[model samples]
Target: MAHIKSRKHPAARRLNCSAAVALAFIALPGAIHAQQTKPASAKAATEATLPEVNVQGQAQSYKSDQVSSPKFTQPLVDTPQTISIIKKEVFQEQGATTLTDALRNTPGVTMLIGEGGNSSARGNISMRGFDTAGSIFVDGMRDLGNFPRDIYNTEQIEVIKGPSGSEYGRGAPSGTVNMSSKTPFAGNLNAGSLSAGTDKQKRATVDLNRKLNESSAFRINAMAQDSGIPGRDVAKNKGWALAPSFAFGLNTPTRIFLNLEHIEQRNRPDFGVPTVGLPGYYNAALAAKGIVPPSKVNPKNFYGSTSDFENVNGDMVTARIEHDIRPGTILRNTTRIAKVQHEWMATAPSGAVSDGSGSAAVARPDPNTWTANRSRQTKWQKNELITNQTNLTTEFKTGSIAHTLSTGVEFIYEKQLSKTIAGAGTMSPANLWNPNPSDPISGYALTPNGAQSKGDTMTVSLYAFDTLKLSEQWQLSGGVRFDRYSTENNNVMVDGVRTRLKSSDTLAGWKLGALYKPASNGSIYASVSTSQQPPGGSNFTLSATDTNINNPNLEPQKATNVEVGTKWDVLDNKLAVTAAVYRSENTNDLTTRGADPGQIIQYGKKRVSGVELGVVGNITNQWAVSAGLAKMNTKVVAGSATQTGSSLNWSPELTFTAWTTYKLASGLTIGGGARYVDGMVRSVSNTANAATTNMLNVPSYWVYDAVASYNVNQNLALRLNLYNLFDKEYVASLNNNGNRYTPGGARAALLTANLKF
Candidate 1:
C-alpha cells in the first residue's frame, strides 16, 4: 500500500444533480410570472418592492442573495480555489435516495473501500491520493473521526479540492467536503415520496415544514427503507433514518437554530462475488462454473436468510446562534456533536481474486488440505466529534472602495474507540457447504472465543481566518489555523500480549488565498495551503526489525499545495464555467507495507498535478447541461520507481462526466448522463519494478444512466430511473489479497413518486 496522501474532496449531499440542472428548470416559474403580469402592474410592483427573497434557514440579520454579502451560495469563484456544489433539488429529481448513490456522479471524486470489516472501512471519498475521513465537514463545522458518514439530513454537498487549511482546521492535503443541512422555511412545504423497485426494495420519505410564528419555523423529515440486493447474492438489507430541525429569529437582535438527526443504517457489505474466476479481470479458469463477479451477483442470495455483512448506526445533534452587534458587525456561532457505532463481519476464501489479478499466491490453501480455507473478520467502532465555531463580519468605507471584513475562529474535539476480532480455520472441502435444510450458514464466529481488542484516541483543534475586500472588483482572503491532536489506547491479546499505547501529536497549519473579481460575474484567484496526518495507536504493532522502522516517534505527515483558477458567468448567469490547475507535493506520507499487519512507516513522497474544467447552470431556458472533466497525473517523487509513476490505487487519471436535462413541455422533462474512468494500476510496494507479473490493473469503462419525470400537478410528480443501461462489465473494487474483483452489473431500474402540498 502506498502512502495515503491528503487531498480535499466533495462533501456528501442529498442530491446528485449538478447546479446547471436545477437552474435551468427553476427559471420556468419566473418566465411564467413575467408572461402573466401586465407592464403597468410589473412596473408598480418593481417600484414598491413587494418583499425580499426570504432565504430559508438563515439568521434574521442575513439577507438573501446580497451580491456583496456572505452567503452559502456565494459560489466558489469568490475564493481563490476550486469549489463545486450539488443542491438538494438534483437528488430528488434523480431519485438519489442515499449518500453512496448520490456521489457516483460528483466531479473529480472517487469512492474508496476501506477493505475488511473495519467500520473505518465503510466508505471514503478520496481526492488526489489522500483519504478524506478527517477532511469532511457538516454545516461548516468539523465532524472528523473513524466513523462512516450518512446523508439523512443533508440538503446540499459542497466540494473544495486542494489544500484548505484556510477555512478548515488541520485538514487534508487533498481537500474537503462540506455537508449543508436543509433549513426551515416560513411557509408550508409538505413533501413526501414513495419508491418501490426490484428485489423487494421499498422506501418512504416525508418532509414537513410549518411557520411557528412571524419570524420562526420548523421542518421535520423522516425516511425508512427496506431493500434486497437484486443480483447473484441478493441478501436482504434494510434500515431507517430520521432528522428534525427548527429555526428562530428574535426581535432583540438575537437568533437561535437547532437541528437533531438520528440515523440507523444496517446494510450488508458486498464482501464480493464468489471469485472462482471469470475472464476480463478475474481468471475464468480459476472460478467455479456459473459464478458471476460480485458486481453482477443478484442482490438476492441463494445461501440463507442472513447476510455476511455488518450493522451501522449514527446519531448527531447540531445547533447555532447568531447576534447582530450593529449594522456592519455581526457575530455567528455554531456547534455540533455526533456519535457513531458500527459492527461488521464477513466470510471470505483465503484465495480470493481482487485487483484484476489471479496468481492467488498471497492466499494459499491450508497446508494439510489442498482445498479452500475460510477466514472471518469482525470489527467495531464508536466515535464522537464536537465542533464550535464563531465568526464576525464588519463593513467599512475607505475613499471610494467599500470593504467588508470577515473573521472567524473554530474549536474541535474528536474521540474514537475501536475493537477487532479476527481468525481463520481450515475445513474439509465437503463440509464447506450447507448439506441439510435444517441448518444453513448463519455466518462465522470469532476464531478465538471471546477474542476482542479495544483502543481509543482524542483530537482537539483551534483555528481562525479572515477575508478582506480590497475593492468592488477585487477581494483578498487569508487565514491561519492551529491544531493539537492526541490519542491513547489499551489492548489485551488473547495470548496475553497486553499492550498500552499512548501517542499525542501537535501541529500548526495555515493557508493564503486571493480572489480578483474582474467583473460582477467572473473572478480569478490563486491559493496555497498545508495539512498533516497523525500516527495512530495501531502503529505500535510491528516486528522486531520493523519496530525501529515504525518508530512511535514518527512525526505527523505534511503536504503543500498551490493552485490557480478562473471562473466565468456566460449568457447572463445562465452558464457558469470554472477551470483550475494545481500542483501538490507530499512529504513523509504514512503508508502501509506488506499484508494484514503491514508496517506503518513514513517513507514515501508524491507529486500530483491536474487540471479540471466544470460547467454548471443552464445553457438555455429549455435545455441544461452539467459537465466536468478532470485529468490528474500522479508520481512517486522520492520512492521506488516502479510504484512512483504509476497511478495510485483508486486514482483514475482521466475522468469524464456529464448530465443533460431537457424540458419537453409544461411539466415534463427527460434527462440522461454517463460517467467514465480511465485505466489505472494498483501498486503496494516501495520498490521499483515491484512485481507487476501478479498484479492487476482495472480497465477503463463507462456507466450510463437515464431518468424521466412527469409533473402531474403543482405538487405531485412521477420519476423513473435506469442505471447501467448497457450492463457494462467492469470492476469497481479494491482490497488486500487482491481477491475482491466484481464485474460491473447489468441494467437496473427504479421508479418513485413525489407528492407535495
Candidate 2:
C-alpha cells in the first residue's frame, strides 16, 4: 500500500516462485509418461499409445510466447485477454534503465505528476482511466514505495490489463504490472556494461554466474549510476544496487532457492516548472483585471536549491522450495521479507513571479528582478512486509474432458510508518527567470513534528483456476478467489492527539472465458471478469469521518469487464497479431454520502471502453518489431460535477507506441521508434471542456528515439543511444492541481561499451 516506505533504494527482487518453475521444467519428461495406466497383462502386450510431440524453431527474442505466472494455462496468443510484455533484451537495447522508461513500449498507460508531500500516494500513475499506483508487483508480490524503479536485475515486465482481482489478491481496478526477477540457473558466465553520456550520465553494471555442480548454481548482479536530467538544472540521480541468488537441485524433483537484494539512492528530486504560460493556463490574480499576458519561462530553469534531496534504502530476502509430486503435478512454496526507508525535502514552485510585496506577479516584470515564492515540503517514511505463498498445479482427465488446474493460498503482513517534518520558518524567494541552485536556503524542515501516521494490513487469500479443453478447437476457463483482510491505522494530528481505527472484511472475485480455434495457429476468444477494492485497501489509511471515502465502514468498490478478441501467429510462427474490443465498468460505493455536497448516493459508476491492436516478433529473421495502438472512450456515468464527463482527468483518447530493429550481416544493428499521447484534460479546477485559471489541458506531443550498436568481437560491442531525436518541446505530465508540469526530455546521447565472457 502507499503508506509503506522502503528502507532504502530498491534492488532486484527475483526468484519469486522460481523454485517451483524450475522443478516443473526438470519433471517435464516424467510428466508425459505419467498419463499412461494399464493392467499388467495388457501393458505387457504391444498396445496403442499417444503420438510423440515435437516443437521446432525458436521464437524471436523480441516476442514472448508465455508469461511467468502459473495461473495462465495457455500461451499469450491463445489467452483470452491482452498482455504486453517487455523483455530485458528490448529495454537494454533502447537504453531504458528505469521502469517508467521501459513502459513506453506499451500504449494506454500514462504517468502522473505526483501530488504534494502531504499526500499518501507516491509515484502516481494512470492506466485505462484508473489509478494503478498500488498495483505494481515484483515476483508476484506487491512492491511498495513510489519512486523510480531500476531494471538491472529484471528479466521481463508484464502488464495485464483490465479487472484481474481473481489473479492477484488485491489491486487497482484498471490492471496490474508484474516484474519478473532474474535468478540463478545451470550456467557459468560473466558480463557487464560501462557507459558515459551527455547530462553527466555515467553507469556501470556487472553480472556473474558460477556453476557449483550439475544441480546447483549461484548468480549475482550489481549496478551503479550517476546521472543528471537533460535540459534540467541540478536535478540528479545517483544509486547503487546488488542482487544475489542461489539455487540447488536444478535437475531434481525438489529444488530450493534463496535471493537477497539491497540498494542505496541519494538523489535530487525534480519538482517541475510552473505552468504559467501553457495553453489554458489561468491565474486568479490577473484574470479579473486582465494584466499583461504571462511570459513563458525556460523549461530548464531549476526552481529548487542545492539543499533539496531524496535518500532511499531498500532491502529484501526471499526463500523458496518446490517439489514435483508426480509426473503432472507441482507443489511450490515461497516466503519473502522486505524493508524500505525513504526520506525527502524539496521545494514546490507555484504561481507566476511575485516579489512577496505586491509587485505585479508577471514573468520578467519591469527589470526581470522579480522572485518566485516556493513552498517547502518534507517527509520521512518506512515500509515493512513479509509474505508466504503455497501453490499446486496439476493436469488431469475426467472421462473425455481434459483439464489443467492451479490452486494457491497466501499469507501477508505489511506495515507503514510516516512522519511529516514541520518547517521552522518561511523560505526566501528565488529569482523566477534565472533561478540559482546555489541560492542559500534557510529554515528548511528537518525534524518531525506532531503530524504522523502508522498503518498495517494483514491478509489471507485462497484462489483456484481451471481450464477445460472441451475439444480440439474449444476451451473453457474459469477462476475464483477470496481474500480476508484486516487493516488498522493510527494518526497523530498537529495538536499531538492520537486516533486509532480498524476494519476487517472478506472480498470475493471471479472470471470466466471461452476460446475457439479457427485453425492450428489462430484463436478467437470472449471473456468476462470482475474485481473489488475495499476502502483503504490501496492507500492503507482509514478514516473516522463519515464523509471520507477511506472510512472503514464503507463497502468495497466493484468493477466488471467484458471483452472479445482474436489472436494469431503468422509468418512461419515468427510473428503475432492481436486485437481486442473491451469495456470496463466500475461502481464506487460512496461514503454513505455522495461526493457532491447536500446529496447522498449509494453507488457511483464510471466506464472505459476501447479497441486495442498489437503486433510483435519478427517480419523476417533479420528484422524485429513491437507495436501497439489503443483508442479509449471514458465517461463518468454518475458522480460529482467535476468528475462527470466524457473524458477523465489524465486519460487520453488515443495513444500509440512502436519500436523496430533490423540486424545487418556485418554484426551491426539499428532501430528507432516514436510515441504519441493525445492532449489530456485537467478536471481539478475546470470541467471536461471548460477552461479555468490554470492550464486546462496538456498539449499533445510526439517524441522520437533511436539506437545503434556495432560488434567489435564475440565478447565486446559498442552501442550508442540518441533520445528526443527531433528535440520536441512539450509537457510530459502535469500535477493534478494544474500548477506544475514536467518538460519532455531534450536531445541527448549515450555511448556504451558492452562486455561478455
Candidate 3:
C-alpha cells in the first residue's frame, strides 16, 4: 500500500462553465475510455484485483449512528462536537419533498418566510438563536444564493452545532447545515417513486445507477413536482431538478468524481395573514375608537394578486479527486462552481388602517375605516460562486503518542449582478373583515428604476486539525484556521449616481477539546471555540460612507462558544443518546452610534445559552426512533437604544421533535411524530407594555404527523403520509415588524408508490 503525501499548489484561476466542462473531459479521457472498452477477461481480472466499492444507499431505519465529516478524522461520537443527522429513510417516511419539510424533525431550528412566501428560495433559517441561512453547505462546500432545495438527490442532512470556525472559515458562529449528495457506486441499481396528495400535489422522483466497468460507475437522480398549499387560494408551487454524477478509478489508489445539478422553480408566493392591530396588542384601544379587530379577518383569506409569481433557476457542478499515497495517508481535492438566477413579483402587505380618534374609536369592516393595502415588489438578480478545496490526512506515531492530522487550503470567488425595478401599482383597498374578491382591481406594471449593482468577493483560507491519542481512554483535539477575504460592490442608484464600496479583512479561528471514553460505546467531552464575521460576510455586499468607500475601521462581529457534552450508544450499540449544555456570546455587533450622527459603532453584545438532548436508532429489533429537544434563552447584554436587554426575534425558548417507527412480521411499518415550537417575541424590542406585549408575541403551536408503509413485494412498496394530522391552524413565521404572518398549512395526505430494482 502507498501513502498519500500533503502538498501545496498555487490557486487555480477561475474558468467559465463551458471551459471547465471541456477541461474535465480532456483530463479524464483515459478514465472514461477505460470504462467503455471492457474485455470480458480484462474485466474479470480487474474486478478480482480491485477492492470492493461500498455505498450507503438508503437506510432501512430512521436512525443513523455514524456521520460523515471532512474536518474530523474520528467517528462522530468521539469528535467532541454536537452533531445531528437526518437519514434518507426519514425523508421517505415523511414524504418530504423540500428541505423545509425535512427540517421539521430537528430541534432548535426555525424557518423565516422569505420575501415572496414560504415557498420562495429566499427564506432564511435560524439555528440555536442565530441566523444560519448563509451557512448552508453541500458536501462541505458553500451553497450560495437563495434557491429552493429539493431532497431528491440528498443522501443525508447533518447539523453541526456551535461555532464551527475551525472546520469552516468565517461566519459559522451558530453552526452549519450540510447536505450530502447521492453518488455513483460500482453496481446496477434503480429506484423511483410517484406521489399524489391533497392540494393537487403530484411528485415523481427517480434514482438510477449503472456500472460501466469494474472501477467506474455513473448515476443520476431527477425529480418533478407540482403542488398547492391547503387553505390558501391561488398559491401554488412547481419545480423540477436533475442531478447526474460519475465516479472513476473506484477503490483504486487514484479516483475522480464529477457531479452536476440543475433546478428550476415557479411558484405563486404567499404573503400570509396580517396582524390584528398596528402594534398587535392595540386592538382594544383601536376597537374603542371604532376600529375592527384582526379576529374578524379569516386566516386563510388571500389579499394578493393571482398573477404574482416567483421563479428560480440554478446550476451546480462539482469535481473531486482522491489519491492514496500510502496505507495511512491520503490526499483529496474538490472544486465546485454554481450559478443561480432569481426573479419575482410579489404583492406585499403595506399596512393596516382604521379611522379612529382616541376613546371615540369604533372599528368596522367598511373600506373607508378598515382596508388592506397592497404593494408590488419586483427584482431580478444573478449569482455565481466558485470554490476549490484541497486537503491531506495522515496518521503517525511518535514515541508513545499517536496522532491523526489533517491540513487543508481553500479558495472561493463569488459574484452577483442585480437589477431593481420600482413602480407604483393601482390596487383598490379591500374591506379588512368582509372583503369581496369580485372587486375590480387594476393590474400592476413595473418599470426599471435605473438601480443596478454588482458585487464580487474573494477568499483564501488555510486550516489544520489534529487528534492526539493521549491514552487508551483519553483523546485531545485542536484545530486552527486563517482566512483573508476581500469584497467590492458597485451600485448605480435611480438618480444615475454610481457608488463603490470595498472592504478587506484577515481573520483567525480556532478550537480545542478533550474527550474521555468511559467505554467503547460512550464518551464525554468539553470544548471551546471562537468565530468571526467581517462586514459583508453574509452576502458580500458592503455599505459605503462619505469619507471612505467602506468603513475602514469597522470591526468584525465575534462570537465565543463553550460546550460540554456526552454521547452513549445504548441498547447494545443499537441506539445512541447525546446530550449537551452550551453558551454562546456574541459581541462587536454593528449598531448606530448615538453620540456621533451618521457613524456606526460595534458596541452590541448578546448571549444565548441552551441545553439539548437527542436519541436515535433502534430501541428494539423491529422498532426505530429519532427524537430531540432543546431549551434556550437569548438576550441582549449591551446594545443601542431600544435593543438593550431585548430578546432576539424568532428565538424560541423551547422546541421538541420525535418520530418512531415499528415494523411487523407482515412487512408493514407505521410511524408518527409531533413537533412543538414555543412562542417567541416577534421583534427585538422586547416591549413590556401589557397592551403591546401580546401583539409582539408569536403564539406557540404543536403539529402531529403520521406515516404508514406496506411492502407489496421485494421490489415494490406503498406509503401513506398524513401531515398536520389534527388540522391545526397556527402562524408559522412573521415578518420583522410583526405586521405579516405565514400561516401553517391545514391537514393533508399523500400516497406514494415506490419501486426498486
Candidate 3 C-alpha error for residue 325, in Å: 1.2
lDDT tens digits by residue: candidate 3, 1-757: 2111111111011213324433332333233334444543575577689996542322265666655555888887788888889989887788887777788778889987655321242367888878888788889988776656788999999888888888887775788888999999999999999999988989999999999999999999999988887777667879999999999999899999999999998888776666654334454445454654545357677767776777889999999999998998989999999998987877666345544434543445553466776666676778899999999999999888899999999999989888886653656766666544445546446677789888888999999999999887899999999999898988899889998887787889999999997665667899998888776777666775522213434677788999998877655456677878899998876654454342445567888998887877877777888888777888888765677778787888888788888888788888899888888786676444433212577777889999999989889999999989999988788776566677788898999999998
> What are the per-residue Cα lDDT tens digits for candidate 1 across 1-757?
3333222211011223433443533453334334443453464566478664543321111001112213221455566677766666665666666555556545667664456333233456667766565677777776544444555466777777876665565566788777777778777788899988765768888889898887788999888888765453444456788888888994547788899888777776554432233233443322333333333232222322233556778888888888989986778888888887877664443233322333433422222222223444566666677777777777767776555566666666666555555442222221222211123343334444443444444445555555666666677666666665555556566676766666566667777777876565567888888876555522222222223322345665677899988776555445667778899887775555455455455677888788777776665666666677777877776544345455556677777677777777566778888887776555534342322222255567788989888889878889888878887766655444344444354577778998888
lDDT top scorer? 2
C-alpha-based local distance difference test score of model 3: 0.77
lDDT of 1 at 422: 49
Error of 2 at 171 (Å): 1.3
Error of 1 at 288 (Å): 20
Please, what is the TM-score per model?
Answer: 0.80, 0.89, 0.87
C-alpha RMSD (angstroms) for model 2: 9.1
Question: Candidate 1 — which residues are off by over 4 angstroms?
Answer: 1-74, 116-122, 144-149, 230-232, 250-252, 274-309, 349-374, 397-405, 422-460, 537-552, 590-603, 684-695, 742-745
Order of the predicted models by TM-score, top scorer first: 2, 3, 1
Model 2: ten consecutive residues of lowest lDDT: 4-13
C-alpha lDDT values of all predictions: 0.60, 0.79, 0.77
How far is 33's C-alpha from truth in model 2 (Å)? Answer: 33
**CA deviation > 4 Å runs, candidate 3:** 1-59, 114-122, 277-296, 355-369, 433-443, 545-552, 592-600, 688-694
Put down candidate 2 lDDT per residue, 325-345, tens digits, no spaces. 999799989999999888888
